[model samples]
Target chain A: MIAGIPISKNSYQALVLSVLGIALVLIMLLSLSLGAYAIPFSSVLAILGEQFGLSLEGVDRSAANVLLQIRLPRIIITLLIGGGLGIAGAALQGLFRNPLVEPGLIGVSSGSALFAVVFIVLVPGLVSGSLIQNLGMPLFAFLGGLTHVWAVYQLARTQGRTDTATLILAGVAINALAGALIGLTLFFADDSALRSFTFWSLGDLGASSWGKFPVAIALIGIPSIMLMLEYRNLNALSLGEREAFHMGISVQRVKIKTLILSALIVGVGVSLAGMIGFVGLVVPHLIRIGFGANHRLVLPASFLLGAILLNVADLMARTVVSPAELPIGVLTALIGAPFFIYLIFKLNKINS
Target chain B: MLQAEDIHFCIRQRPIVKKASISVNPGEILAVLGPNGAGKSTLFKILAGEISCTRGQVDYNGQNLKALKTHQLASVRAVMPQHSTVSFPFTAREVVELGLPKDSKRNSERNIREVMELTKVVHLEDRLYQQLSGGEKQRVQLARVLIQIWEKKPFPRYLLLDEPTSSLDISQQHIVLDILKKLKSQNIGVLIVLHDLNLAAHYADRIAIVKDGLIAGFGKVEEVYSETLLSEVFDHPIRLVRDQETQQILVSSNSKFHSDLKISKQAQA
Candidate 1:
């Protein structure tokens, strides 16, 4: 018998979390300090320290204002949304018992995107800071995302059992429907509206400001925490739903909670930062490969790695062209696509 | 006691498990022996509360199965299904650890280790579950369910398993059944669905022979394991061999059915 085997596993996961946590801090600093206007890393720290009543001298006003007001909220929002997507992906994958299942597969992204496009095309004489434009589009898109999940969930459930194959098929149907709707709305969009739609579709983390921070916390932060608390449930679920039910998990209820939580995360994320992909789908796989597939480890690690990936990608996106920021959506795919191909080859070789 | 009365299940108006009654008592093993597609698994599923029967009810310790919540039932019983697979790359040890109730705060590591040792899967702890052999995987899954009800409680508990020995070799099969037999001392009743008649005859305290969606016989081994009944339930010519000293019942089947071939011999379901 192995003494302290579980302890060793716990320590290993703790070590992984610590490393990811430290790396996230470093990446957050680097992302903050090195943007279109480069501030010194120490100054960025000092500016942040000043908030906590720590006395640090030689703080420039504009630099502090830019760092505190512009960069910090964006960073915080990115972390929340990115972490939300990662954990959501991991949870949804465990819920469905498929590693490949992502936030995109169940029509959350497409449904939200469809609603966003319709809002853009339909609401004429756009007002930037008006009450309707400020809240209307996001609310519409969020509802759209949630409604699609309900539709897909009902379609997949038969005889009180959620069939896995049918869930994916239902996703396909909803996605196709949403795709057609998006195409239909595109017909009414003017040239300028079309350009903005293309940009929004490509995704931008910069859309979030200090104004949106509180709502982002309410929408994404709470759901991510709930997902994190579901590690044990997710672990049991990966054994297959029938086994989970026998092992004391309310399988149907867990599935619904997981899907709804995932929808909330992705829905609000799509609202805040337009359709950023790949991090949700691939970050969990990377964590599983590096560490084992225990949800206790997978969900948190996916969250950290997701935040890191997005921050780094956002860093490059804003800096690569210098003042002309590339869409984070384009960069994530560019970064994520090649690495995914490489992973496929690596796994194939390992299997052979 | 775990009791199911007149349980009938139907799929699309076609009967699967029809009007079958069975009970598992504390301190004994009840083996459900049947040919493939004889509704053995479906019956197991119904008793395990994985699915609600179309008719009749299951009661565990006098509590209606439908009235009891899943977690409530879980504290009193554990189930090992016929087929199970993990989707992610969880370690075998991790998979086994899932059996521990989320709210359980006991020495779980020791519990998992002890159960792994009991199931003879101690060496496969660190190995990825997907990499284990079929027999190894079966044992691991058995350990998972066993861990659920391993710690003794005041009330009687039940263990329901379906075809646990199907993937195991002769020695491994005996090991698994021996573990189940040991549960009787813990006041835990075990209801196992098995294919091998001799194994059931050897270890089962009581036997239920299922054929064509109904139980052909249910009683003590001596009253149930007759040569004629075994042959009829299995639909093949059969004989029973007895060890001279041990008086053990060994079932043997060879040659075709005494009756003419029927459609039941073909694939059911």
Candidate 2:
């Protein structure tokens, strides 16, 4: 019960969750409305109201098209990817017991990207503008993510256990190796392949549509939800693996399940949104700072906060240099780097 | 009572613990004494169900340790490792609360409060776990394990501790041993790993000395502890002699006397 926090253990989590929920809805509406077309908030609501058969009038046809056809899909993808990465990051941080571990830094997405590149270069027939190809990319990406993480896990494991330092070192080595492979692919890829690879590397959300929405949701949403449900087990793991086992938690199961689930979510995210970095790492850290490290609070809160963060970053990407859009990935780094530095400073001050 | 018989543990084709057989009965503290690398912690791990033994069986009451469900074993015993490291900056209160089982009918908050008070960590309820001193952390972990087996059931429960007193000061060590002693009154058996021979000699009702991954001696303190047995187990000359006035047996390492005698003999020569 820190004075400024005002959260008493049990009810505090519910209250924060409700608040985050409302804020997420508000941000979602704002993101759907404020873009290149500048649709009014009232019009956005009117467009949404029509879905419920309220039939609100006075909506411009073009604004409706912009809201439904363009912005709605982007927002959905952003919300899912953001939420997925956030919870994955939180679970991973809990598993590794290190605050600095994240999907972006740990080569999970790099693994997905590398695999997606391989699919594009090695098996171009699988992704030739067909619905199945669009679906096949995320599947290949998931396998890539699984492979990279599996390799890292194998490398980090010594005597049947994973230590934090070894895991970190393995992640670094995997990330470097994936980067080299990606660079090698980029060298020989043709024009269209090169363009797709470049956009995927920088994380382009412009290609999002209702067509790929269901696939992304199935991959990212399910795993993220599964991770969220293990909040108690994850909290138990904070006490280290041995203590967690004594507390009746299946520690090895938790590790394997979380690693696989996070890899899937991160892989799907990379395939759909390209390499949107820092949402996973930054969002969970911020949520933990605000709501203590209880996984019950941290997991769900990270989800909502992650969506809010990515939506805002995507908004900035669209509007900051109006008519000339910046990559969403670049904007997130711009936002995330300063906050990372601030976290380091805050941690140093606390230690002193 | 908890019983482990003929336990053999190996890692990478190397034997770490060999042919160890021991048991802790109700109303007694079994202190395991062993030098470093003698596999004391590994034995605790096997008994605590943290790892499976290569060969042997651990039984609680009549149920095989490996056969018992997690929740069933959880109700029967709790284990505190040699070092407890928590990642997040959990409040000491939160750390204790993590011990409560999902289906436990006991009032969790009350148990947390009572155990914290019992372990003398109530004052540290608000402090972050990582910020606590080593002794404080050990006490907090002790409180957690105590909370797990706090409720008295129809059957006896067990608590396995690995060097519980390693980080505590002399007074704190006494407090912990006293707490373990109190637990015996409630029919809870405790298996504690101890490095201090004197502490084990005084507090433990039974002592099991492990040497080179094998049990060198195991029995009631007075029956098993002798000059030759301890000296051989510890690789140091030891003597168990009665004090003339107190009529209580004292454990003496005798290093000073032996070294002095060597110097006198050199001078004479």
Candidate 3:
């Protein structure tokens, strides 16, 4: 109904992006200020500015270390992972043309989780070294995620064309198999390995350091930006593959690009954050509901909102239980599942 | 300006369109009519470059359709499938705007409005595409395709539509056909698959009746709409009648019951 509004489409898009960007920055700053041993707002600002040579007196050293060294890196990782999942989810939904579809619906996270479990339980000693612990786990997890998505894509393809239903079904089967493999790994784990597996599966962001940020950015952030750039092709695809082809879009190339980009993003996010859930699904859905279904708007909006949502969620994870952080994944699923159900009902109502 | 030369498309071992050749000249409406499995849609796909012909080639303005880059080919040809269902809620205007070329953003607003007006879907532009009636959706889709090839260039353009009026009421069907007629006047070729022979007789400049993956009859309406040719192609008894006032040809079904009932009444009397 708002389609007939007098506002120009370009202006409306610019307005929405501007407002969302401002809100995201505000939420991010609030997140930086709301943790245990909370840094004062001034110190948070000063520490952020000090890095750019803005010397402000009265900055506490401990607060600076906590904000700059500890919290900032963790928050940055959370933002990147959240944004990555969000854009990936939006792209996948547009490609599939199913509002209910998410990045994880293609078995990327489960496959990566399976590999991470294998690393923890099967070769526990390999993860103890700093180099392997930091770099190796994420690399192997990315490869695992990429492999599963490729496998699913291959299965879903018939005569070089991928069907949405077939892809989703293949994802379901791959997830079940990966889950079984993970369970088997769990069964063979020793006590220490068992604890670590449980921690990793629940998504521990406590290992966040400046050292891991570059790898996460290189793996997830760049691919996510690439997905966002596919706004036009994704929008065309919403009409169906044949329509897209007729619209001058290379439908097959778009499909393959989106699939690989989503896998890389979700793969990297899972490896870095340990299988966080719901941000990808919920953020993009909410963006579509608020704005129109234009992918040009939806994809970037998803990134901003996804970052805000996870930063806020991570803030909650650190503060709610105090000193004992709840697994971010558990919180996300608890929040995401009900929201997803509500979205389904809303869609049905609108359709009816 | 659009020609499909000896197009043969097969699925595994079954031929869908075999050695079928059809062409549409600029400033003409060519209607393809046939039975359910007559392969009209497959031929349209080959002409629009949606699928490759298994044994032949399509040419637009003397250029091979397959060899042209997709975007380049799209500038000259636009296709509307039989049914296009968008799951998400896109406004009708947004759907129409999707047809605009990437480089024509500066003129997009004007083009979108003009096409919507041309298709008689300007009123429905504000409504969600998913919420529109079947006829309205078809019109919106038509507008979308029209916008795609609306730009004037050195070469001719083609519009290919598949069963566009299948869901429309009588007046809506005329509105669509009239729009195509107007487009034809602009020197844009139109290729349409129609189920109604009468509508084809009214609007089409040429008629091609397809039967079992082959062109059974192809020529001007007068040459192609003979009683035997149509009846044989559709596998139904059909009679071609002309209107007394306008001299328009109309097709009527020669059902067995019509003659049987007449004979029974005569016998009783």
Candidate 4:
């Protein structure tokens, strides 16, 4: 229904991508303007314009601190996390040749989340300042994700082929084991660490700052570029592994690279933003339904749509309850689940 | 030319294809014929480089298969597998375009249209590939493979297919084989595993009859479609009828072995 206009697929996809890009920019500006302090949209623009020597009248000085010091980093980090999660889902689904697959289905989130819990619990000294917050915790989480993915791939492989069914089963086992391990680690945590951990675990973009943005960008950005480079191989792979092999793809090599890169991006996102569910799973599915299932179109569209969806959701998260912020992970599911169900109904109506 | 020598493929030490040697030259069609569990598909896989044989080497135009990378080998050969499922809702045209080799110098548009027309699947080009019927999907896949080797090359090329016409009706079967027949003019060799004896007899320029993971008969259709050779290879009585006007061989294989299972068991008892 999103692409209901009668047009060529290339032009239609272009129109959709452009719309999503514009919407992302608009939603970011909107998010900056609407919060507890309520900076006006024109003043938000003037404050941004003042940096380039185009100052305007009545742009309050205090509002500039709230806009630049507080909201901008949050918006930028929110976009990065959402975009990374979306493309990770798209690439993982393509590599597995299944629409149901997401980054969590492969155990990256739980694995990374477990290590984060352990890092916070066991070494309370590291949690005090920028050293632990910026690099140590996220790095530990990234390595944990990498280890679990390697284990899952090993369990799924038979001879040379990685059976997708076995991969999912292994992921489920690792998730359960990791979940239990995280719970065990939590019992040792002090009150301060436990409270901080709870707030972070619920997926907060409010934690984003200028200092953390650079690392998040590098961690999520590199893997996204790598994953996007594999569009051709992933396209061929969906036709079946042997089919891809016959077309000159090194199936095992592509499979491993795709899995690792997706894990890298998803691992970074989970460690950076906590457990933001629904965006990875729902965003890619929405794109595939709106646009045809070409990875060339699906990947970019998912990235943009994901950024837009999460930015808008986060804006609502901060504003809807005013001083009491809602957990983004909970809100994404609450809002996105109903929309996903509606799309499924629309698809069935067309099919019938 | 595509060549595999003494190919032995095993699983858990149980040989699926053993000591099966065959070669397909440019400008010819080689139909691999056998009953179920005869390892025809396994041999086809070995030849296409989908799986490495446990005890043999495959070569493309005298170049070692193991030494070749995916991109290098892909330009030389394309394969249409027995079953291929696209996970997403890609249109038939998009699926076919997936076969366009990255380094192809030809016009992809003309190549796609020409291949789809030859396979008679142009009408279904915009339809979702997963929504197609069995026969339509087969033809679309055939179009996908054909587009890969459609352009003329200075070097030899090969196309391998596994039971490409199993789902097609009689007329569509002829259409499919006729497309392969025309590939001979483009200097592309085709090796197909065929289950239908009559279709193989009519379309294949040469034949390789495999039984028990070994070649039971190999030569021209006239040389290999013998009464004793086919009957023993298939483990059943079969009759070969020749068209008097055209001098073409036809096969019929409805005999006592295919009768009621209880009657055959009683007789054996």
Model 4 TM-score on a 0 to 1 scale:
0.93
Between 1 and 3, whose TM-score is larger?
3
Give per-residue CA lDDT, model 2, range B236-259, as digits (tens). 898665555665566778777766
lDDT tens digits by residue: candidate 3, A297-328: 99988988888888888889999998789999
Q: DockQ of all candidates, in order?
A: 0.81, 0.67, 0.75, 0.76
Docking class of 1: high
What are the TM values for chain B, all candidates?
Answer: 0.91, 0.90, 0.92, 0.91
Stretches > 4 Å off in candidate 1: A1-7, A124-127, A130-135, A153-173, A342-352, B256-269
Model 4 C-alpha lDDT per residue in residues A308-337, reported as the tens digit of each score: 989998999999999879989889879767
Residue B222 in model 2: shift from native, Å? 1.9
What are the candidates' interface root-mean-square deviations? 0.7, 1.0, 0.9, 0.8
Fnat of candidate 2, please?
0.70
Hey, what RMSD does candidate 2 come out at?
3.9
Where's the lowest-lDDT run of ten residues in candidate 4 chain B? Answer: B256-265
TM-score per candidate, chains pooled: 0.92, 0.93, 0.94, 0.93
Best by TM-score: 3
TM-scores of chain A in all candidate models: 0.89, 0.94, 0.92, 0.90
Clashing pairs in model 3?
A: none
Q: How would you order the candidates by DockQ, starting with the best?
A: 1, 4, 3, 2
Q: What is the TM-score of chain B in candidate 3?
A: 0.92
Over B145-208, each residue of candidate 4 has an lDDT whose tens digit, in order, gives 9888888789999999899888789988888899899889989999999999999989898999
